[model samples]
Target: MKKRSLLFGLMATLVLSFASSAVADTKRVLILQSYHAEYPWVTDVNQGIRDALEEERFTEGDNLTLTTFYMDTKRHTDDAWKQAKAREALALIKSLSPDVIVASDDNAQSLVVRYLKDTSWPVVFTGVNADPRDYGFLDSLEAPGHNVTGCLERERFQGSIRLLKRVIPDASRIAVISDNGPTSRPILRRIKTQATESNLNITGIKAASSFEEWKQFVREMQTRADALVVVTYHVVTNEKGEEVPPGEVLRWTLENNRLPEVGFWKWAVEDGLLLSEAISGFQQGYHAGTLAAFILDGQAPREFAVTTPQRGERCINLSRAEALGIAIPRDLQTVTTLFKTQRVVK
Candidate 1:
């Protein structure tokens, strides 16, 4: 009886040791974001990722370890600086040796994933504006076939245009404006194609890299076009050759522009754009986080198909509409999310 009790105690100790080892086996994930933490869009994406991880019971610093690196590419637009930052990120990745890497937005994919492509490490990306094929990350959307897969932020140009038509029935001509950046170029191309395919007259498509140029283009469009479609102005440089904050550009437009403005991002509606059929940044990150979880569970990234946003939100700025004397349709009010206050000023 004594011998049997001693054996039972040894067995219990071994079992407890194994359980502790299993609990201590934490999986590490690295999230590489192209923009800063304070940027609203990036913040939403991060929130989505965190929420999804929480749903999976992957608590950070517990069963899972998460490390995030923000390149702040929006503020630092110089090519040389971007390259240096990419090198720094790569070094950090080497040190971390994370099990999975999540690259968010165009710059992160362009700088980090592009370098680590076809490697043993798996990469999941979100908020990629351009075709993954354009960056040689995949053979086709249907089959990534290797280690990278995530979601694409399809530009909602046609949908936003249709909504704009509903808001401004008599408006015949429109101008599409965006910063002349790598990410914006692909979006502009799609917008132009959609404009050509639709019935609405596209007065012009303007890409402005500098703040002074952006203001000039807006002023020109005010006379030449009935409405303006804002894409993104996050990377536009100011008159002093410094990167201009997106809020500053939106505020300038709100104070100066006479025509109704529409956009593809929800933040634009909050920032005083008249209306938008906006893509949810949070959804993009959530889907990407889901994919990351799959990878963490030993599923290959290639096995999960690349996905696009399943839904778009129709957002209206009521205060801006009232200020412009444009009456919102009763049906639109029922279906759309309305914002009364300007989220950004000056």
Candidate 2:
């Protein structure tokens, strides 16, 4: 009887020990994102988020539980629906109260901030362009002063124009489409200043707030613009006040014209954008993910200043340009990040 009791005690102790170890190994992360379902770049961002968590040894199905909620994929156009979806996501997040919340872009970050700022959960965001100071997310890049810090998707505007010049050797006139958002003004001014200094004929086309206006604006530029430079998609807001993919608008513009479309994201290639001297959204996600994982693993968010990865790929679709009868300059080809062929349905 004593032997039987001793065996039972041993089994109980082993079970308790196992349970403690399992609890210690489990790590949970919640991603409050906006654009994963239909957006190609968000998939890359999700992969980077996974990669970042994995780098910290938090493997999925073993030590990690990643809960992702995409609020702006299918209901991106309906403002009321988008808010309702966000509210539902917030309720779920508030219930789980995960270790960390990784937001992919400015809009996503804003959503998380709206719903989770009062809570103690840390938020690590990527692709935020408006200054942290003005946005109230942090005091400065050197010291975030809050539980929010990640990667910046900002870029060198002059470099992009130089790339455009390289791609279209004889191209001199450039048209910039902007939406007058907080992020657009600085970039427009800086790029315009630099492009003007370089003797490039650049025109800043301020787009209206409506889709019809956008189409009309594009149509107007088609007559005078040598090449179309697509600024951030922030100009193309959905009914929910969220930025929709700018590629569709550009694609519509290019359908009848023969101008080159230069965009910032690699998916722009898939969207029929001719080339990009800009950063890859996947690479940006990877960088952002690394920092987010670090913060989630007990590292302080303010410990790291805002980081901007200068490394980016120069993606070019040679066939895209050729379809428009636009020649790719040799020098531009030398520095091209990606060169591939895709059919334009016309």
lDDT of 1 by residue, 43-162 (tens): 989888888877887779778889999998887888998898899899989998888898999999888898787787899999999988777778778999888999999877777877
Clashing pairs in 2: 314-337
lDDT of 2 by residue, 15-96 (tens): 9999899987777788777765656767877887788678878788987888988876332545576667777777877788
Give TM-scores for every candidate, taking all chains together and pairing residue i with residue i: 0.91, 0.84
Q: Name the 10 consecutive residues with the lowest summed lDDT in model 2.
A: 337-346
How many clashing residue pairs, candidate 1? Answer: 0
Question: In angstroms, how far off is 125's CA in candidate 2?
Answer: 0.6
Prediction 1 TM-score vs. true: 0.91
**Candidate 2 versus the native: TM-score?**
0.84
